[model samples]
Target chain A: MSEKPTIEAYLKNIEEGHFKAYKCVDCGMIIAPPSGSCYGCGSSNMKWAEVSGKGKLVSFTVIHVAPDQFAEEAPYYVAIVELAEGTRVSARLLGFDPLKPEQVRLGINLKLDYEKGKSGATYLAFKPA
Target chain B: MPLNNTNIVSAAQTKFGALTGVTLREIFSEAVDKATIHAGIPKKDIQAAFIGSFIPEMLVHQGHTAPLLLDFAGLKGIPATRHEDACASGATALRAAIMAIESGLYDTVLVAGVEKMTSVSTSKVTEALAAAADDQFESSIGLTFPGVFAIAAVAHMQKYGTTEEDMALVAVKAHKNAATNPLAQFQKEITLEKAMTPRYVAWPLKLFDCSPISDGAAALVLTSNEKAKKYTDLPVKITGTGQASASMNLCDRSDLTSFSASVDASRQAYKMAGLKPKDMDFAVVHDCFTIAEIIASEDIGFFKPGEGAKAVRDGITALDGDKPINPMGGLKAVGHPVGATGVKQAVVIYRELIGDAGPNQVANHDTALMHNFGGTGATCVVNIMRRADL
Candidate 1:
């Protein structure tokens, strides 16, 4: 039998221009950037679903010594955002200038964006609301 | 409980920390010379070889280079094999030597680990080290080894209330231990004030809290128990060795306060050696980062979780403490030449067990443990050994 379309595949399909994730069938737990399995239940039987594309800014760090690939965007802000769906994801917390760790605070709404990649890898990002 | 089955008669090492112009073969040759001299054995005695290295492709652009290096080291015809398990390559090499001696396939075996990390740039070194983690899930997320350990530190602090002061104590003690160790990379001691004031490398981790990028090699001359007695009256025996691995991704675990692989491997080693943590007179646990050392102290059952840091602050982990650890400055002070760290730990254990560790030796030390972990605890090896003459 042919394998069913993965949750990541389904989310990437509908996320051609929009950011989205999934919710658990049992505990309503959310998996962000879309995952194939539920961490809560360990079930592969997950479904692609849409989120509010909004989250809370939980924590952040200013990566001054960026990786080689991310060197062009040196000293960028990487933050953990807890979506309205209650799942946390890491991304470049945009719409901020010369970010510092102390500047970030908990319970700040964050918005997600979907972007086409230069290397055929779809990208997801978040920005302060 | 007698691992009189296998013994290491001699050991040697190359100067660690950034050998700028040395070739891999040159490094191996230096190690070979030192081992032969220490063992008082001829080069012709090595009947087999086990070589350990990480990222030779990036550093030297060579694959299957062990046979060539062993040949150049004058062990051309012996069965030489390469062992790579990220940073645990040295312990793996030692394990291979032990197995060979125990199997009666080779009466004398040479186990060496060589890595030329300085041949690459700083960024390249970071990238190469990341290869120890899962590329698809961990590295793809731009998570470097420092970031991985940083996450663990955060989780441990959140769960166990470990403080920055606790982490600083680890660096303090390691530096204190390294100050008296001639072979240590940083032979100067730093006070807790200095360690606490350093520039941050990652959240809750500073530059001094981490092991320096080092280039070096280490080698051990393994002989059957019978042959070891002929070389030295106090050759250390291979009492117990155990290795275990855990999930490659840090996000895949239920708890981050302790390394599951370390706990499991230590349990196995202790059982095999017929001993417990309390039975150990001293130990050298992996301290790639200060927090790693603290967590290791707990995982090895030296302290309760979250209590390791307190123990350090309380002076319980000092060299004069009841359960001294990392008396040779550990990876924090001595430097961690990734592939060479495991064997170096063994060498430290050898020194202490023989009461040859001047100034740093625990009084009356008999049995000791050496714990080495690879890539954020994804792989761990713990060995327990006692004075062979005991």
Candidate 2:
């Protein structure tokens, strides 16, 4: 059997606009990539919460040399993001020609970007708002 | 002291280090031969068998090698099964054999652990081991086992004021013990000054803090007290065997300083043995990284949580100390051949209890424990033994 799509699908979703998510009604917990149930409250009480597609860049690491699968995108930044609703997420940060930690501010507003990979998977990416 | 319940009548191991001239199967055969000879028992006498192996396919492109190797070793039709739990594979297998005897499944069993790590490149080995971690989170971040342990070391220093010197002390003691162990990988003692000179594999963890990559095998024969008499007059009984598991992802943990798995497993073993950590004469802990030993000592109740680092600094865990740890050099110096490590640690304690540990023997040792941890403390098994009859 073949392996499941993981990081590949995630990145591809960022490249496309069809990125969907969910939020817990009771605890105000945001669920990235959407889920049938709330991971926080363990309740089935969830609703389709359309994100503003905006957040803050929490932290990032610039990979000078990427792995074989990501070699073409060498020198990219993988950042952990805190959404406007206070949920944290991880995604590839785009728009900066040359990524640097100093350039990536802690509270800088981030706008969502949709990206597509060679595998025909659409995913979510991020850029400075 | 004599064995408390199940006894280890005989123990043997391949010449550990970088095994260059033999395959895993051959190593197991030799170890089985030596163990049976030492116990003065025939192959037909072993009622059951357990084999421990990790990453055989990655190292040798072979799977389902355990039963086949047992058959090759002349135990053609015994109840044999393979055990896999990362570095704790061998120890867990031994614990299974002990439990089988204690539970009256079989009167006698054979336990063996083997790994042929030298056949693979260092990078491939690292990659294979990383699979034991949270592949989606940790490995995705390019965090190797050393890197995971490095984070723990940094957390220890940050939370408990553990210094680099404290970490180096563990390496120093492990090497000193290995200096006298013929089967140890780096059988030479190193000074604390040399250990502190860091060549970074990961931040806050130096090359010296890591255990050596090794290839080896170890085997032992286990039996009930009644049946043990048929083979040998002296047998080290398995007093207590315990195991525990935890969250695979570090991000899910509330605290990073101590492995809750080790704490629970050791507690179970101590309870089963009707003893406390304070009653132990000595121990052999999983020291895949120097920081791991320090943290594990505290988690297993040897010392107060934060005091283990201080204890190391004070020369309290040395072979001559009140509570010696890893007297057989540990994985740091003795080598971490994964599947073989847990069983090998048991062999060290069995020899010591039998007055056969040679130069590494602690003075007047009676009770001992072996801690085998799999992957950044995700899984753990603790076995307590004594030189007394049940």
Candidate 3:
């Protein structure tokens, strides 16, 4: 009952410095990037559920040729992080040299954060825990 | 490969490159006219049309392109539809014709794809093409197609020890094959050092590792089995057709090393054709990037999970190797017109099967496979075609 189970609501929370997830009210399942229906049982019943903001890196990329908005922010790392709530989200990876790709490891622990991009857009980001 | 009566009687394509003084209308009409003439049928004989177009609206300020393209082909009111699935739009449009024939809806159909990208600036084209990714999540975070595939490249390297050298080998092989294709965009071959030394588009992915943005058009004439023999002496039977989709976002996928869509589609296509990947004589997969070809080869069951990189490195996927791949140069060098790439892949294999591939012919290219992939592995279509004489 903290906030509506909408992506806008989820982003609002992230913008206000909190990483949120969606939990199925019926089956107690959790998912990220907010879905209209439950992935576990296809139930539309859902609510905003807070997560630990802790996860592990699954896969990642260092973007050199960015879109027009982020042209100045080339050579940034984007990663897929699995949360403790058993859901995954795409976020920017920070606190590591982008040129040294070999130093990055898979399945490493990361902590969630939020930042503003050159496009003046807020996005989810993460750092090595 | 099922025993259906759908066959490709004729196919044609405009040379893929920076074609000047040609409008989309001219490019599409040229391919249509050539295909119609080769089919030995008047344009009036065409019953329906399907077009694969990604961004006529964005690039040309055109919408409802199906009828417009149909009008250009002289088939104005015959139930035309334009399909859009990012890069897989060509195969998606091709599927409509196949379905129309399978359901007895139309005996003769025109399947075509066209894209004019060079007219716009490179930044405008980049913005337009980025529409294929997950706009809300992936693209919002500043990921381009090159960056998307770069992640896959790095993941493959980390998981299976795939080296950048192995990735460069794919580019080398692709250019070698393209040099033989007179219609290909980049007919000049490059060494591995040249390919590797180029400026990086994304980390671990150089400029040479990516498929070029091209302008081209291709058309195919399809007919029901009963009508195929009357049109052309050499008919390539579309024995198996399979399409599958995955998560829209790259991060949502459980595995980055392989695309589930390709695996599911190829498995279904193989099951329908009653043959396995090993039985295929050759293949043309979606090599949008060098790493993509490696992953696609593995995803299509042509090689083991991690062997795709090594396959290219060990000459296992060369033109004369045991499993020949991309003899028509693939998208790497043949040019990817985005919406037209998948259809061009089909046309290449079709030519190889009919013994019309001047000197690029393989010894055993009797049966072939073509993999058409859309954005970020979201949509994929795998097709198995066999020589009519077989």
lDDT of 3 by residue, A1-129 (tens): 655588777777777777778899889898888778887898988887878889999888788887779988888988888898888888999988988877998889999888778777777999999
Best by DockQ: 3
* Model 2: lDDT of residue B44: 86
lDDT, candidate 1, B1-390, per-residue tens: 545678877777777777878888888888887888655888888888888887788777888978888888877888888888888888888888887888898898888988888887888888888889866544554556766676677667766778777898898899899889877888898887898884766655677778898888888888887688777888888788889999776645546678999999999888888888889888899999888998999999888777888888888778998888998789888887888888888888888888888988877588889998888688889988777887
DockQ of 1: 0.22
Compare the candidates by lDDT and give the number of the best one: 3
DockQ of each: 0.22, 0.12, 0.73
Candidate rank order under TM-score: 3, 1, 2
Candidate 2 regions off by >4 Å?
A1-129, B1-4
Docking class of 2: incorrect
Better of 1 and 2 by TM-score: 1
The chain A TM-scores for the candidates, taken one by one, are 0.73, 0.71, 0.93
Q: State the TM-score of the second chain for every model.
A: 0.97, 0.97, 0.98
Cα displacement (angstroms), candidate 2, residue B128, comes to 1.5
Candidate 2, residue B131: the lDDT equals 72
Give the alpha carbon lDDT tens digit for every residue of A26-125 in model 2: 7878676444566689776665456777887654445443333444555555555667765655566777753333344555889988545443534356
Single out the weakest 10-residue window by summed lDDT for candidate 1 chain B. Answer: B135-144
